[model samples]
Target: MLLKNPQILYALFLLIIPVIVHLFQLRKFKKEQFTNVKFLKKVQLQTRKSSKIKKWLTLLARLLGLACIIFAFAQPYLPETSQSLKKKETVIYLDNSFSMQQKGKNGELLKNAIQSLLTALPEDYHFSLLTNDEIYKNTTKQELAKELQQINYSSNSPNFKTTYIKAKKVFSKHKNTLKKFVAISDFQEQNLKDLEFDAQLENTLIQLQPEKNFNISIDSVFVKDKNIENTTVQVNLSSSTATDQLFTVSLFDHHKLLAKSSVNFDDNTKANTTFSIPTSQDIKGVLAINDNSLQYDNSLYFSLQQNEKINVASISDAKDNFLKKIFNQDEFNLITTQSNQINYNKLSHQNLIILNELKSIPQGLANILSKHLENGGSLSIIPAETINEASYNRLFNALNLSRYQKKQTEELKITNINFSNIVFENVFNKKVRNFDYPKVNSHYYLNTGANQILSYNNGQPFLKQIKQVFLFTAAINKENSNFKQSPLIVPTFYNIAKQSLQLPQLYYVNENNNTIEVKVKLDKDNVIKIKDSSKTFIPLQQHFANKVNLTLQNEPKSAGNYSVIANDKTINLLSFNYNRRESKLNYANLSSYKHIKTQDSITNFFSQEINDNQMNFFWKWFVIFALLFLVIEFLFLKFLK
Candidate 1:
């Protein structure tokens, strides 16, 4: 019972005037001579009783009516008991991810939600809006209308917990302020799961459901097989409903359609279609399918470029026939340099640097190789029969690799391949138990702690890697070991060189941390830029001796084939697509969470919030009371006499 205008209560003092008039107007009952004295006495007593009753009732009603008018002007109200003192603060996280392309009753989920918010919210309504890639703080809906219209499906994938922490920072630190975190999304299962709410803040999860019955998504595209004549590309597809399992998939070379194929998903969630095209020509390809579910996943962009030969540099003056046979001239630019003939400046240009049976390492050569490994090149060390352990250990310490303790005469068979390593992934069809195990007659006892790539039968590592640095304990010379002739030598050495120059893939997911390696020679002043017609920006790049590593954290936000430009020259084409994680129509069950509420849309939530029961104004009820008191006074004055 609080008064809005307590100063209006000063008018209550005016009621004293009516009381003074009632007292002053009261006159002594004048005794009048009448025809009958007894009759006059009886009538006088009755008249006095009736007049006093009517006067007192009229005064009571008049005083009440005046007081009610004053109270009505005061405009008192009862504050909300739920959050009487707390000021509400709303923070909204609108998920503009690729999954929001799904259509609902009105239109696309994102567009419909945006329109509804603009319509429901007032122009001066203030709140913070957070999207996956950008944040708008303490802005009004009128200002947000223009920004919201410009939002596209973002490639930046943000989990719920991470977005929550980022959103919570924009709220006020006052304990008495009530905070509300509203997350509006399609609530895809990959993005939001097991959301634990903060006790101090209120939460709302608004899930926009699509009305469409069926959804088809282009899962991925990869090279199935390739030969001199043709390259076969496999495009994977998936669907939510069985009614539309079969879809026509088209392959395109930029805008020109190359081939068309139909894929039937049947009962399985996954199906693939293949297209054959000439392998000799570089391809800027796109795999497209007609699906109404999500437009972003309907087409996947990819590219293929001409192969570049890997440069291999060997530092040895010994017999080079075995090395020459393994690294042929067709695929490798193999150069053998002696210890004295080494050019330290050009050593980092090679994709792979081989120290082939170096009896003693020069301090300067070891130092250059150390920098080579740091620049993301590959290094393989084949120790000699007798070596300087002290100099080798110095290189080892610089590379953060284990040291060679001492020499061992015990012979060991090189068995056990770490097939799970990224180098051997998909290289082996099945585990081979029986093979000609390479043997080493004498080897150094390499000390502990390295990722063992090829281990001996006794579990001692024959070959191991420490961050692209390959070390073989036993020398692979014809006199010391027969590992030079072993079949394991080809893939073990080739993958090391291939992985060093990580070529751009067929297509990369833009929602992932992808490092695309481009083979180009650029001066220190130059940089690389990836651009299409609509967007152009420089990616985070690190230049080495021969190539540059372009780390695509989040660029080319849309799915398309973009050109890699160096010094205004188009050197290569890199393709990026949105991740297919949002393609599947899976959602989280928000009912399991106790602290948050589930709503259909922000429009409905705003309606409920505007009509809060906490604002109970007493002014209207006071007006009604003033009218009733006036009627009571009228009835008393008119009918009581």
Candidate 2:
């Protein structure tokens, strides 16, 4: 026991003043007859004995009253004897990751643990709760309870290192007070190994252990055959125990089961199965295993769309065999045009048009190509081997290519090739080879707003871009180099033409005069452009990172199509059809309670324990004692009278 206010001990000095008054106060009696001297002597002896006893009793009562008052003034409390006691400002860290949704006997193990912690809280004790989702600080009981109820398991788990750093900052604010941390979770070995705990935290980890049960989940699903119109969807399943179990795998199209198959898994074994689904129509479905596990991975959702057709047109001299061999396939519409008979307006409708070894674009062609792009078309330009600077600059400026100085002829070989989504998915399917071409005398090297896709041996860009248009200035004609004879000739020409012909999906604002709200997911360095009929790219009134809402400079005269392009890849036109799945949510029932116990080595200063028997009285007992002392004083006075 300890006194909260020890200064009250000075009240003992008041006892001396009471004692002095009692000693000084006296009364004188009149002289009596000699006959009564004997009786008076006997009475005097009795009176002296009574006086001594009463004096002592009065002093004892006063002392007792003073002691009681001092004890009351100095508030005292008992401490706990246990060593593993917690502090008053305890911080509880709860894991709310998706893994915590694993069912126990009663329900979610995390839910049960939280409920137990709430039930065990003492009225005088206060605590704060943090979770893997977010931390709440200095909150009231009602607020904490409401936040707890609002918490749901999330797929994204918080990084332990980040949480530890945040916890350190929060704990540092209360350095003067005792602090304790309690982490409640499954404590899976995988999750624990990556965690770095702060050395400053006085913490205890509680691992909840639920009953072990067998679980089988769909590990992965993918299309096996790329060319086959009817695709094979493969599913892989795994189980913990080696019991031969029969399970059903179902494929659903818009919640309707299109196909179902039953398979048996040998005890403690893995299985792989395939289901054939026709790729005729765009299909979205899932493969589900009939086992109790995490639901997110149980059913894998996928979407499949049809491939778009690519149209290409090539302009070359009648004797150009390289262009002839590359576009020989039926998929390409190879058009040859002489300098005199070339009609540039007809080339606008084609997805890709190539100007090979051209001295100059016809009078209205450059402006026409710009209008085609503004209307959502792609173009590729291959400058002639021998060309003047004025002619080269005319084509370069039209494609937004920066000005450059010409370099002497050198044997350039394709060395590095980039495999972007445009190249791998839309163009060549990872089949590209090196080819040598004679470096031109007056070819321009791009400086800005251009991405070098393929580089030569000397680190010069062999294939580069200027906005949506692609330019390949390397020698392909027989006069300059033997590139026409190489095996890479067909794939290189085919890929370049296909990429240039692609067009962006047209996006139209519902109301042209009003604010046009466009929702798109964009990464850094991506440019968004809005254009008018004159083919001028206009900057938006306000540019945002992700979502954009801006008023157009002018109202559109008619309801037609607007163009949108990103990183040179056109959005799939068919994907614009809006399709959303609406189904009733099926929530699993809560499981039973899981037992977890945690221990800490540090002592708990706020621990409540019953102290051993000690000499102590309640305030009521002291009041009764005071009343009894007053009664004794009254009886003594009456007797004296």
Candidate 3:
């Protein structure tokens, strides 16, 4: 037994007052003649005995009442023995990873675990719930449970080390009180092991087990096309098991299965297979294999579109045999014409027009090409071996060049290339060794609304792009400099022509944020439709120049394949994948907490060490006892009278 207010125990000293009053009782003796001696002797003896017994009984009751009152004022209580006194907050960590989706014989494992905890939780106990998804502190039971039901398996999992460190900061803010942390999760091998908990937190870790099975998944897929007729896609599959296993691989184009094949893999080896896709049809679909690691990478989607052909009109004073050979490639339709005789109206029909080493651009030629590009056409301008400044500015001004300056040649190489741009995709597979280009005597620098695609060592623009037009300012002939014979000649010429001609039939939406802006490059003004699973076609607003920004509202709910289309052209098809490292279900071990003290290990189960305002009701009981003693005293006095 313990007293909540020990200071009140001093009231026990009041017992001495009762003892003194009883001892100092005064009796009045009346001086009366003792008559009738014989009769008086018998009566006097009986009265004395009765009076003594009554006085003693009354004193005893008074003492008993006083003692009860003093003891009641002290406010005593019994202590619990099963658990230690808890005077701090409790934080509970719950694992909500995908592995927690494992079902037991009855139902979901997490549901059963929470039900058990609800039954054992004390009525006055307060706690917070933490999860692998996120943490919620100082929340009520009902609120936490509601949040728990809303949690689903996520591809991205939380890092235990980072989470633990955050928890430590939360606990440190309330350092004066004791903290209890309990974590429940699956103990995967990859989960945190031997992690040192913050010394301040009294932590208990619980590891839950889930059934496991072997799985195989397609690691990657790549498409290689050397020509329009032959395109081969290679698929690579990775597995967990070492034993030989057979798996089926299937190829599909827009829900139509084109081919299927089976292959066996040796233990722990990556299996590779190739399938030839017919270029005759516009192929857009997925290649998939059966696996359970994750569904996003299980299937790969790819599309192939018809290559656009560009018409090239070359005007040169002399027969540019090298330029003719380069333009003779099957992709380009090359036409040779004299500078004065070239027809400007015919330039509108061609995707690109080349001015090869022309001393001067004809009077109406620059204006026609400018209007052609303003209406959505591409152009490449190569200066002549000897050019006047006035002719160069006339051409440069039409291309939106900000400033034109001349620089002497220096020993430099083109070392950096932008690979993300579509223009240079796979154009230069090998390095341009010992390639020296003519030292640009004069170069046009772009300001606003322009991006430098490639730069030389001295930061000079090797390849510059303004709006949709690409300009290559290098000299085309060897007379000005030996640059034409350099290794950079073929790549430089090939990239410039390829970028100016190729039309985008497919778009890849690679924005990190939700929305993307896309400009359509089409031959005519046509209505384009964008649709989703609902099959509702939204007519895209075609701003001038066939440019539109496709606004994707939010990320797709589930990570998988998604596509957006613009009329016959499939604008973009992208895969949404999340980091799987956070999906690991392994939990911290709980064995270290077996010896930690908790409320359940204390002697006084209901006694709170921190709260002192609890009502004892001891004084009320004492008052009742005192009233009962007074009643008995009154009854005895009446009987004696």
Per-candidate TM-scores read: 0.81, 0.64, 0.60
Query: Higher TM-score: candidate 1 or 3?
Result: 1
Each prediction's whole-model lDDT (CA)? 0.83, 0.56, 0.59
Q: Which has the better TM-score: candidate 2, or candidate 3?
A: 2
Q: Which regions in candidate 3 have their CA more than 4 angstroms from the true location? A: 1-137, 158-213, 226-231, 252-257, 282-286, 292-402, 409-461, 464-473, 478-531, 534-544, 549-554, 560-641
Q: What is the lDDT of residue 433 in candidate 3?
A: 36
Q: Candidate 3, residues 75-142: lDDT per residue as tens digits?
A: 66643532233356777766666555555443555665566455445545567776665777776655
| Cα-based lDDT at residue 177, candidate 2 | 64
Instruction: Tell me the lDDT of candidate 2.
Output: 0.56
Best by lDDT: 1
lDDT over C-alpha atoms for residue 246 of model 1: 64
